[model samples]
Target chain A: MTFFEIMLLLFLIACAISIFFIKRLVNAVVVFMSYSAIMAVLWLSLESPDLAITEAAVGCGITTLLFILALKKVNALKEDGEADRDEHNI
Target chain B: MSIISEEGKKTLTSFSDWVSANSPDIPAEVVYPPKKDDHGHGHDDHGHDDHGDAHCDAHEEAHEEAHEELRSSAYEALHASDAPPAAPAAVTAQPKEKETVTEEGPMTERTFVRTLGAGYRLIAAVCGVLLAIILLVTVAFLPRFGSAENPALNEVSRRYLEEGLTDTGAVNTVAGMILDYRAFDTLGESIVLFTATVTVIFLLQQSRRKNDEARALEEEDLQQGVRSLPARVVIGIAFPFAMLYGIYVVLNGHLSPGGGFSGGTILGGTLILAHLAFGEQYTQRFATITRCTGILSVALLVYMGLKSYSVLTGANGMESMVPLGTPGSIFSAGLIFPLNICVGLVVACTMFTLYSLFTKWKA
Candidate 1:
């Protein structure tokens, strides 16, 4: 198809693959950041700069902070030995 | 990993050695089962295998879950390690601290309060879910409602053009409606932002002040100021431009599509930029700006509303001195300009103030 469409398709594929295979939470977050950037690009192509900006800022900025905060809480659980010990039992 | 890079080569060799050690005589064809079912001739023969397959699938799922749990914990570890000290302390304290909120002290009273709170929470959740579902379904079935384009877009544009254009006198009818015709709504939006900022400042200010007092009593600077040279330089350069652009957006509200909201964002962005550059210390210096803007915005909104609307409902008989000069001229939009400027200032100040509150912590 068109070059723009091809790029969009590739980005979607990359996002899907990352979502499927990325295991580490931090790595997954990094992938999500890339995914957000790609989505913003897709939005730009669709002629929605406002939506793109919102996605970039809120999705990548605030959401990332929240994710990091959540991960921090999870880490605290790990340090407490609950999450790590439960993994072996699972 | 491949044989190309040093690490890749080492990993490959190690893996290969391990594989060979585990199953030296295994063939690749033997390792991988056939694509199609080869033993599907009778139920008797395949029944046991099918049961085993089901069990294997279940086991695999559990294994995957375990791996996921491990990864999640690892991610948490990394995050906690990287986080600022205050965050861990807050998080740790949350679980340990018992919430002593009571319902007027009596058992019957407490039970009633609990039930009422639960009922309200349930109702709110249900309403939220219903709204989301309705929006989703509408979006999905939007194409069935019309042919080539979104009918809602055209309908909204038409409404803005018909009922709003003359009053605001802007060529871009949508902009005019957003700024002047619905100036009160814009004002409310600005006030909402201002309120958020004030709330943040109020919440953080007390705790921070208390901490400072404690530190003073103990004779120690428990809090360390921010220090990033690159951030300082970038903020120094960007802050002026952001402020200038913010003013421009507010000033040129009538001339352009952008108004108060857009301008305010630029102003807010400047604060964010400074916070990013100089760290949290710089935010304290700009508290005056935030407070002044918060008060000024609300006062301006109230004054504008009264001055512009004689009766508020059926007819808005606001008069403007500026002539609706031409269709596309910058000076044409009557009250849209001033209204937009007010909105921009309010939104900017509020956003920055809120962000400041979020970044700062009680030492």
Candidate 2:
């Protein structure tokens, strides 16, 4: 059980670092969702089921949806007009 | 706030004088044209006066409105009250705001690309190192994590852990602490969410209108973009199930790990599915920003009212009329049940509102 928890934490850190350096916004957001799910697992293993629930629902579910909706608004990763978007991007 | 003595004030003035002397010469102000009207409608008049083609005119108006809407109302209110005499000074006060947002751009190509050579990067690195050292020193002095004698393991927390269920009729100790003992903190969190939503809506209201204009054109066509056959079939199955699970979590919060916060997030996720699977226009039929705003405000107000009453009762040393029905039961926790409901409403509304605002509320 503890081994699984340690594995989850390591995966969580990996997800976080990967998301940071992914370059593509959509891919970063997908990685972020995985990170949130892994974090929820970590919280569960810590005997914090309430935080785990929130981390899964709000962090994994809602935040990822928020990111995807935003990507749609920006027409993200389409690459056709990505060059134009790149210049305007912060 | 520290009280400044006469000597301290004199020293401040001397310091100001020294700064003025040492700093580079102040640049002469390049004043903008005096705003013609009090309501910041001068831009509106200018937009209309162009007499351009309808589509282009509409586009320009939308663009102008979006930029103008980004500006603070407090600044505009001050402009309105000043009787137009202080217009020049006010414009100068917000130098960046007055800069023309036009096709060519505000700054020249040379200015945009200009760098401070190597020295600025070196200074930044040194400052970054110094800040890191200061922060590390502060962290080094903090009580170690999970230490038995740490301030975080105070008596209040221990008492809550021991007696929270018995006293509050909530099996979930976290729920008891947040929604009962320290409810004001949760109230503040809800208010923060409400404020953020309000700010986003206000800032993007004009863009939302622009999006609606585009939507108006697209609305005439049949719905084709988001809702494919397979996507529709899957979402139709998933959406209701998600909503069911969300409500279950909220209702059973006192007995379980989940509460309004997490359950609300689940509910919000359901609505996001409504947007993605059904398409913007389809979803907007039900989840309008106006409707969300109404629910959000009402929920927050109710939460405040409930908490205020609780606070007053506690202050007066009076027992609450609310019944603690039964521990480990559904209807057991009295006010916690209603408070959780209110929090759920606020959270769902906020998530929906944020999604709407970020996408320019196109639906």
Candidate 3:
């Protein structure tokens, strides 16, 4: 593998591992988003531009937006949870 | 196996501790009550070995009122039984200790769940390791990567590379292969997208009549939408060009690397961005629920009709009438161009509908 490909693969593994350890759900989603972005780039390097574009749009864009919206719905957003905690303390 | 189980136990405990710490709904007193001097001490050591003494002390002070509430209930139960008031303290000590013991050992329903979860983790890890070993052995036996002698570079691929352009009348062999040669497969994919959209709509569609609180929340969202001037400005500038690019990619599928799926996703993303920037009212005017359903149904039907005609004609050994026009042109591919358009429309509508359903409707 090329150096660039190796670096991307290593970063992908790091992102996967860090996602399990990340305390905040939002941060985990963000890490997963970066992983998708790297995967898209990897697809391009592998000479499948069709998969690259689909991965960029579907994996990075639509999936991340859906995850954030789900987080908002469940009041799992950090700001929302912090506000709820303050109200409970009162 | 024992080492893996020990690791699993550690992970399970840490995960549970993290959940109890982060979830605001569960009260600290409910999770970690004040430990008494006798049985509580041993169980606390067993369960909360990693939890510092300072953490326990802080929870003990913070939940002092909860302690008083529990103590009063215990005292009443003891009084009714004609036991000494000091007996209430002993009875109170047993509950937390019992709870901790139940959590650590397989004793109750909660213990059953814990055991099942741990068993699941063990099985999954074992399966993963076996699959990895199998895959590695298989790979080791295969020909080297990129070797010309590899079975992947067989006559089937050679035929596609040599005659795909002439047979399908498309410069892009991938498009020729998918849309022309394997048109039925593409039809199946389009139908799958349509089915998924219908399932999501069926599951998440809200009732026609909204409650007052939901209406108020929607109004607030609209107000917030209008106030975001910078987002509106940015999306307004980016929207048309992105839509144009998506259209370009779809139209040039027979001549380029991208085809229906990528282009459709880009189109769907732009639609989502427009909805975000212009508010639901503006987007809903053009992309209503009924309109999206109509588009999806029409696209899938058209794809099915065209592919069925081609398949029937080819099977009968008759000279199919659809003219394969000159290669390297947009309209050259006999059936590929229209098929791509149909797939693109189905995918785009499905994506946009999924986004709208998720954000606007109550599940």
TM-score of chain A of each: 0.75, 0.84, 0.86
TM-score of each candidate? 0.53, 0.67, 0.70
* Fnat of candidate 1: 0.00
- Model 3: per-residue lDDT, tens digit, B64-177? 324433433422331222222223233344456653543344335445666787788789889978998999999899998778999999999999999998889988898899
> Sorted on DockQ, highest at the top, how do the candidates line up?
2, 3, 1
Q: Alpha carbon lDDT of residue B127, candidate 3?
A: 95
**B1-363 per-residue lDDT for model 2 (tens digits):** 233343333322222222222221311111111122322444343332232212222322333333443334432332232223323332333445343322124235324533543456678789978998999999999998578989999988899989887778898888888899989999999999999998988878865454333344334322333435688788879998999999998888888988899999899888877776776677778788799999999999999999898889889998988888888888888789989989988998899889856754442
Q: After superposition, how far is residue B62 of candidate 1 from its true place, in Å?
A: 42
Specify the poorest-scoring 10-residue window by lDDT in model 2 chain B: B26-35
> How is the predicted docking of candidate 2 categorized under the CAPRI scheme?
acceptable
**Per-candidate interface C-alpha RMSD?**
11.7, 10.6, 10.2
Better of 1 and 2 by lDDT: 2
Candidate 1, residue B257: how far the Cα is off, in Å: 4.5
CA lDDT of each candidate?
Answer: 0.52, 0.67, 0.70
Best to worst by lDDT, what's the order?
3, 2, 1
Candidate 2 Cα misplacement greater than 4 A, ranges: A84-90, B1-147, B211-213, B218-225, B280-286, B360-363
